[model samples]
Target: MNYTPWDLVLDAGFLSALLIVGILLRARFKMVQAMMLPASIIAGGLGLALGPHALNVIPFSDQFGSYAGIINGVVFASLPFAGSFSFRGKLHGARKMWAYSVSTYVLQWGLGLLFAIIILGQFFDLPDGFGLLLAAGFVGGFGTAAAVGSSMEAAGWADASTLGFTSATIGVLVGVVGGLALARWGVKKGHAKLATSLAEIPQDMRTGLVPVVSKREPIGHGTTSEGTVDPLTLHIGIVAVVTAAGYGVGLGIEALWGVKVPLFATAFLTGMAMRLLLDLTPARKYVDGTTVKSISGTATDLLVAVGIASIVPSIVMSYALPLALLLAFGVVYCVLIFRFLTPRIFKDGWLERGLFTWGWATGAVATGLALLKVVDPKSKSGTIEEFGIAYVGFSPVEILMAIVAPFAIIAGLSGQFIVATIVLGIGLIFVALMGGGRADAGNRANSFSNVAP
Candidate 1:
């Protein structure tokens, strides 16, 4: 059957209806608010339960899953222009933050592989590249899950996306819920600073509306007059061009070398080149990084809903036990990084910083931001500021990990790749320790309860 634009429009209509309902539920239900669930997840869950998989009521097409791959290409490719993701924030705790952030990223890649090799593969029949799913899904969230899952599928793993999305779904839930638990624990232990109680988090965080003028933030600056070209359209056009060009490059590689390259990597590389070229020209003035990032976020919200709704129930069921074990191990590993690792890595604001990293290290950057907002609503903890500066070092290594791991596993270099992650993780830990943070920072803060908020 031909996929008409009308089909897309219809599917979008269904998802949009679900999104509206989800937003209403979030706004009206205190339980949903207490859980801090994103509207997209709620929308996706409704889509999943009501669509083809369960009740077959909504009539979403078979084309649902592919949207995640296509849209995530935009999400990741837009990173090069993420002005707010920042390479210019204050450098107060930048070194220590970089070490912890980079290490968490690298080590998750390694640990996921180690899980496959040491335990999961020995007992069950799985794809050789199967281990990458844990790290891909849990560490980087849905966008990276889509990228890595798509890459692994291209490498001959058939059930990759289903498993990867499953990991991501669980990751976000645990990262948020467990993160809040950790925050409370931190407060009881006298480690928390400003976030004394989760109940005290602003009501507006639960409802996505800006109730007053003072609470509103600009979406982005208009660089072009609407009479000529809308700024939003212009930004989307730029992202589309970059993503399409990257897709073309990927096709070119496959035609020449008989190899399938992941579109996300190619897209990021293309975005980087385009950003550089624009930087050298006067055209840079017309491009707004924040606006481009907004486009990415828009794509992400849709992709999350679509991705969850498209999960192959049988595939997930078949791999259920292995999924459970892998996720359990991954969750424990990430929690330890938050509990034992990052606290020692951050000299000050360990409670807040560690909690944020726990969210990011397991989920996505947004998860970190969500958790951070609850704790440091005014953004006083300096976590994101440090992250902005540290992101300069973080981006390349992250892209490299996404590029290398699947191919390495396919080539049977899993052992060597695992070793490399260990070495990198150890090196990053040493860097964090040497970067001016006290090794005992986690245990030193016992009087935080006495401090005034």
Candidate 2:
């Protein structure tokens, strides 16, 4: 049967519909537990059952092929750039904070590496050894794992893609669950008391809806009663300009450094830098606060919904087990680090809770807002400040992590698990040294002592 282009589009539509159904089921029926599997995955599972693997309604390859590019684009689009913004005091403390933050990051990375090596050797029945499979685990999570596995499958490796996807999925799951569990635990244990404390702040004092605050009067071309430019126009202009500039810069950087940083990343950084630059300028005063909030929310929501929907169902099924496991592991890890590590490392404040919240919930400043909302949904000041600082501060950290992650993949691919462990160990040491003076940094590092029961 000839798979027409229309057929491809139709398949994408079907997958999208499935995702929507899953979301509705979760909301309407409270289907599966939260901090468990994502709604998207559950939907994918349903699709798989109905597809050729079980019933042959939807062929996996055709569905996947139709939306690969779009799904990949969505992934990069959702990544946070310049997420680490802080007030002057936070910046001063950052030198100390780095110790814990870096350690936490490395701990996660190290666990992922070790998990891959152990699983590949002991479990998967591979023919060309387990180097690449391990690499897949370290680099991009389950999706990347699956991608690598698929490549290997073409080259005569059995279940390579499946194993890779499994590992990556495990990582994502662990990250989410671990992160949220920590959030809940922190509140239960007073680590999240900052949330309660933030309630004291009045609503008007919070971060206003404006994207930037400028000192200049509304003497420019367009002005509003809210004391700034038209919110809609400004937002559209910002998104358009930032997106274009980012792509341009990403291409330039790729050419100069011989490293392939995606355009979306470039755009994200560019957008962040632009934001900071605008904020620091005297012109910031003329921008309406409301516009900023609306723009940011729209961008994020669009990216999340469309991106998740476009990732054709076939890929999900092909790498189901590995992806599922990776996600599970990620959830577990997020909980562990936050509950056991964050409080010990950071002094109690909005900053502390904010860090824990953001680390797991998309690793972005949006998490700051969410944490703030949990504390006082109506207030914006403290939340905005936290979000701003986080957005700026996180950029460098993310870049650094992204750069280091590839190396971890390389080590995994080479089958030098010991070397991988050593490299990760050294990285953590640096983080500890940087954040070591802080009284809260956890000295009781995670031992392979217990796996999630």
Candidate 3:
């Protein structure tokens, strides 16, 4: 195909049209909706149709090669600005917060890895070193998958990169699936359950957690009107700082530890670290609601759009059945497991946290956000705060996982990948143990209060 700059421009237009079609279908068609159709998977399918791996309609060229990259940078760069969603005072509930974070992180990551090993590993012909990279990509999302994938390629394990990319591509699919399913769950069960507890929330807690919807507009009124200091500006600026700072910090950590990590992970960690510092100081005000919502929402939309457009269809087709099965089973298993075990093993906020973590582990920050929105639109404070912190924390984990995956493969530990998964599970359980007491206390208090009496 003879191509020119105009062709590249056309590609973008094609993708945009496809996205609109996809979104519309999501809105109108139940079978193709976000939860049922699997947004990423559908997007990916469209990409396959448009991308060179299939019809070659969106063939890669110098002009379009970096198109996806530009979109990614735009999406990611907006993160820090969105960092302000979570409420400040909520973190003060020290023991409970700690318990929730530790337990959720452990279980989410652990279960993800275990599932990868037991299910995905059995079907996909993953090379040894790349197994972890593949796992991280599918389990940890794109940043981790790419970070480790690139490392594998650099270390002369190019085959691992192939697997990693393939896995990451599928992981995004899983993310959409998991996120949408969770949203359905939240709307059906989680929402009502949470609302009951929220109705009786302490006045003080409600004060901290209630979304201070601008009184300037009536309920359901869209976007704050013009001339009001655009909260998006603050969020965009903060996100820039967070991304740069994160890269810098991750570089420093790599230099000190003599280990490479995922830049996204580093950026995420850096943002979280700054969040902690700001929370400690009087600077918490720097992160406000508008900034958080704008940054997070915009970045997520961009990421999802770019991600769907970028997955070369040929790659997806190469591993079609396995990837399909991985997503289908993973989504089914995760929802069921969390549904049953969450109530039994953990209580209240921990269940929500676990659900959110699972979404992040399977997908990315956007998935988490969508799920949280369904879980508690009113308590923007708790949901946003948790998301902001989790987004940052997830960064380093991705980088480290990505870079180390290839080595694991070369060492022939592919068969024993379950060991690493087991360790992750144990860690989650350990955190749950620490937080279980506080969660029980909170649950009791919530239950006895009859929801706001």
- Pick the TM-score winner: 1
Q: Kindly provide the TM-score of model 1 when superposed on the true structure, using C-alpha atoms.
A: 0.93
Q: How do the residues 310-420 of candidate 3 rate in per-residue lDDT, one tens digit apiece?
A: 555565567667656655555664565466645544454544555565666566655555455445555432544434444444443444444444555555564454567
Candidate 1 lDDT, tens digit per residue, 90-143? 333356777778888888888887887789989998888777888888877888
Query: What TM-score does each of the candidates earn?
Result: 0.93, 0.53, 0.60
Clashes of each: 0, 66, 16
Could you tell which candidate, 2 or 3, scores higher by lDDT? Answer: 3
Overall lDDT per candidate, in order of appearance: 0.81, 0.45, 0.51
Error of model 2, residue 108, in angstroms:
2.1
Off by over 4 Å in 3: 1-8, 28-31, 34-44, 57-125, 133-138, 156-300, 317-341, 348-358, 368-421, 434-453
Highest lDDT against the true fold, candidate: 1
TM-score of 2: 0.53
Which is better, 2 or 3, measured by TM-score?
3
User: Pairs clashing in candidate 1?
Assistant: none
List per-candidate RMSD values in Å. 4.1, 10.1, 8.3
